[model samples]
Target: MRIAAATAIAIAIGLAVSLSSVVHANEEKLDYDHQEKWQSALDRAQSPIDIVTAQTVRAEDNEPLGLQLWHTQAPIEKAEDNGHAVQVNTHATEAMIRGRHFTLAQFHFHAESEHTLDAKHYPLEGHFVFKAQDGRLAVIGVMYQVGDGNPAAQAVIDDLEAKDGKLPQPSIDIASLLPNQRDYYHYLGSLTTPPLTENVEWYVLPTPVTMSEKQMTTFLSHYPHNNRKIQPLNGRAVVHHQG
Candidate 1:
C-alpha cells in the first residue's frame, strides 16, 4: 500500500510538470497595443480600418459580391472562450464570394467594433473567418447595435454563459446572425489579430444587426474591450457593393 501511494504521488507531480511545460511552450500573449512588436503588424495595409464611405469607389468590374452562405442544421462543433472573446467553430457550413469557395472556419466577436463606419463605432462586431481552397482567407464583418433581443446572438451567448472555457456541442444557426441586406464595403487588409498577415480580403456589411442590452451585457462581462485600434488605409481603394 505504501509503495502504491508513493508511485501515485510521483506520477501526479510528473503530470503537473508536463502540463506546465506545454502551456509555456504555446503561450504567445501579444496584447492589442503590442502589435507593433511583430513585423507583419507594422505593414501599411493592416486591417480594421475605418471605412470612409465618401472615399470609397465602386468596383471597376462591377461584379456582384455574390455572397453564398450555407444555412446548416448541423450543431456547432465547438465554442471556446479564447480568453479574448467567445469563438464558435462551425461544421458543414460554407460561403462563396465571387466564385471563390471558402469554408466557414470560425466566428468571433469584438467589443466596440474593430472597424467603424464613417468614423462611428458600433457596440459589437462579429468576424466570420473563412478559409479558401487555395489557403487564402476572407473575413466577413458584421456590426451590431444594442436594440431588441436577437435569437441567433442569444443562442451563441447562451453557450458562452453556460461554459466559460470550451463548450460541448451546441446548436446555433449562424445564418440568422447576419443582416438581411448584404451591401458591403470591400477592401484588402490584414488580420485584426496578430501575425497580422496582409493580403486578406475584408467585406464589411454596412447594416447593423440587433442585440438586446442584456445580451451586450453578457458579452461585456467576459470581454469589455477586445477590439484593436484601426489601422491606416495606405492608398487601398475600398470598393462598395450595393448588393
Candidate 2:
C-alpha cells in the first residue's frame, strides 16, 4: 500500500509538469510581444518594417509584377471577430499572384498601420492573404488614409458594425479593395504575428485606399489597436516595383 501511494503521487507531479509546459507553449504563440519565448519572432527577416521609399532600390529587371486577382459578386463564406481583428474567409478563386496560382484565404485589418512609410503611420491598413499550391504564403498590404468614404471597405465594416462574433453571407468586394496604382514595394520577410515564420513574401502598395473618418471610427470600436509593432530590417534589401 505504501509503494502504490508513492507511485501515484509521482505520476501526478509528472502530469502537472507536462500540462504547465503545454500551456507555456500556447502562451508564447498567442502573445505577440513575447519574442523572448519564440526565436523566429526575433529572427533577422522579421516583417512590418519601416519602409523608406528613398532608401529602397529599384528592381533592375524592370519586369512587371504579374499580379492577377479576380473576385465575383458571390457572398463570402463567413466574417468573424476572432478576438484579434475582423477576418473574412472566402472561397473565391479569382485571386492569384505572379501566375503561381494562389487562393484567397482570408483578409484582416490593422489600426494605425503595421508597415510605416519613412516612419509615417497611416490611419489603417488591410492585408489580403493568399496561399499558393505549394503552401507558400503571400500578403498584399494596402494602406488607408482618411479621405472620401470607401465603398469596398464599408461593405465589410457594415457587417461588423451591427454584430461582433460572426456574420453569415457578408458581401465583400475583393477586387475594389486595391488602389488604382500598381506600384509596390517588395521584400522577403516573416509574418507580423507569432510563430513569425520566415521566408514569407511581402508586397506593399504605395498608393493608399481611402476611408472616411466615420468608417475608421467603426473599425476602431472593435480593434482600436490591433497592429504588431514594426521589426528590424537586419540588412534585407527592399525591391521597389516601378511598373
Question: Best by TM-score, which number?
Answer: 1
- Alpha-carbon lDDT, every model: 0.72, 0.68
Candidate 2 per-residue lDDT over residues 1-243, each given as its tens digit: 122232223222222222112112223214544545545533777779999999887765734344677664546755557666666666574554544677766777888799999999987888877666555566788998888987767878766555554653367777677787877887777666655666666789889988889888888787777677888888777877765
In terms of lDDT, which candidate is strongest? 1
TM-score of candidate 1 against the unseen true structure:
0.82
Which pairs of residues collide in model 2?
70-94
Runs of candidate 1 with Cα error greater than 4 angstroms are 1-30, 33-42, 60-65, 163-169
lDDT of 2: 0.68
Residues 1-243 of candidate 1 have per-residue lDDT tens digits of: 122232223222222222112111223444656656555534877889999999887754646355778754447855557766677777567887766677877788888899999999998899887776655666899999889898878878767666555554367777777898988888877677655666667889999998899988887787778888889888777878777
Deviation from native of the Cα of residue 216 in model 2, angstroms: 0.6
RMSD of 1: 14.4
lDDT of 2 at 5: 31
Residue 225 of model 2, lDDT score:
78
